[model samples]
Target chain A: AQTVTQSQPEMSVQEAETVTLSCTYDTSESDYYLFWYKQPPSRQMILVIRQEAYKQQNATENRFSVNFQKAAKSFSLKISDSQLGDAAMYFCAYMEGGTSYGKLTFGQGTILTVHP
Target chain B: EPEVTQTPSHQVTQMGQEVILRCVPISNHLYFYWYRQILGQKVEFLVSFYNNEISEKSEIFDDQFSVERPDGSNFTLKIRSTKLEDSAMYFCASRAFFGANVLTFGAGSRLTVL
Candidate 1:
């Protein structure tokens, strides 16, 4: 079984600043995918960014990027130029890659607060 | 943009009563799933349906729970006898047959069992 852990329960960043949310996972499988999802007060899960284990290069999506260290089993999300809209509960998720698919194991979550 | 739709954004029911949550996935999606999140916990997968049958289910999906795609567009999850602990937000998601396994989720239906 794979388990994702988000050590920080809460994080705050000043507007226009950068913030990094930490995440770590324990999985024996060599092939897998890591994802960061955001849930606003409305509770809608939105995809932030994703990283494939095979890719040594980190994945970047606009202001959102991931620092994926496969050897350390760590995948952290970085939000640059944080805005008020970035305030939400961020979750780190893990999914099996190979033949199996779709079931996502999520972390406890980190509540992000973007201060103006 | 295409999105997953779920009905009864909020539902209130008494313990021991039956409750059904409905969702309409993307038109072209081939896989459907049900997940839930307690007040402050992480989202947990309940079940996944493919080809009109359940392909995967977690232990949380017990005998009391059931899922059906009764028609061409609706996917529903029924809790035979709800309990107070069942109060949570239920999310419906769908994925296209071909993709990086990205799932689009609905806004979620908040169930309050008293």
Candidate 2:
């Protein structure tokens, strides 16, 4: 079974600054997908960005980006120019490749606090 | 972009009662799923539905739980007997057949079994 681990349970960042949330995974499958999801206090989960294992370039969505190291089994999310709206419970997820049913394995989550 | 929508944002039911959580997945998406989050725990996958059938299910989806897509737009999850342990936020998600495996999720429905 594949498992995703988010070591940082809580993180804080000042407005307009940058912060990184760390994530790691255990999977034997050579091909897979990684994603970062943001759940606000309202409890709506929103997709932040995604990275494909086969791609060497990291994924970026505006101020959100990922540092994906496949060989190291690490996928970390970077939030630049952080705004108060970026505050949320962030989750790292993993999914198997090739004919996947879209079932996701999620991490414990990291609570990000962005200070103004 | 289209979004998945769920009904009864919050449900309070007594134990042993049957409760059905409903969802309307994105119209064109082919894959649908149900996941739950127990209070402070990580979100867990319960079941996945595709082509009007269950593609896969987790151990947590016991016989007490079942899913249905009665109409073209409505996908429902029915729990035969609710327990206090079943109190959690139930989320419905869907994804298109061709994408980066991106699953669009609905605002979860909080089910509280008393």
lDDT of each: 0.94, 0.94
Model 2 agreement with the true structure over A4-94: per-residue lDDT tens digits: 9999999999999999999999999988999999999998999999999999999999999999999999999999999999999999999
Question: Each candidate's TM vs. the true structure?
Answer: 0.98, 0.98
When candidate 2 is compared with the true two-chain complex, its DockQ is 0.85
* Ten residues in sequence with the least summed lDDT for candidate 2 chain A: A94-103
Candidate 1 docking band: high
RMSD of 2: 1.0
Q: How does candidate 1 fare on TM-score?
A: 0.98
Q: Any runs in candidate 1 off by more than 4 Å, and if so which?
A: none
User: lDDT by residue for model 1 over B1-114, one digit each (tens)?
Assistant: 999999899999999999999999999999899999999999999999999999899999999999999999999999999999999999999989845568899999999999
- Using Cα atoms, each model's DockQ against the true complex is 0.84, 0.85
Supply candidate 2's per-residue lDDT for A19: 100
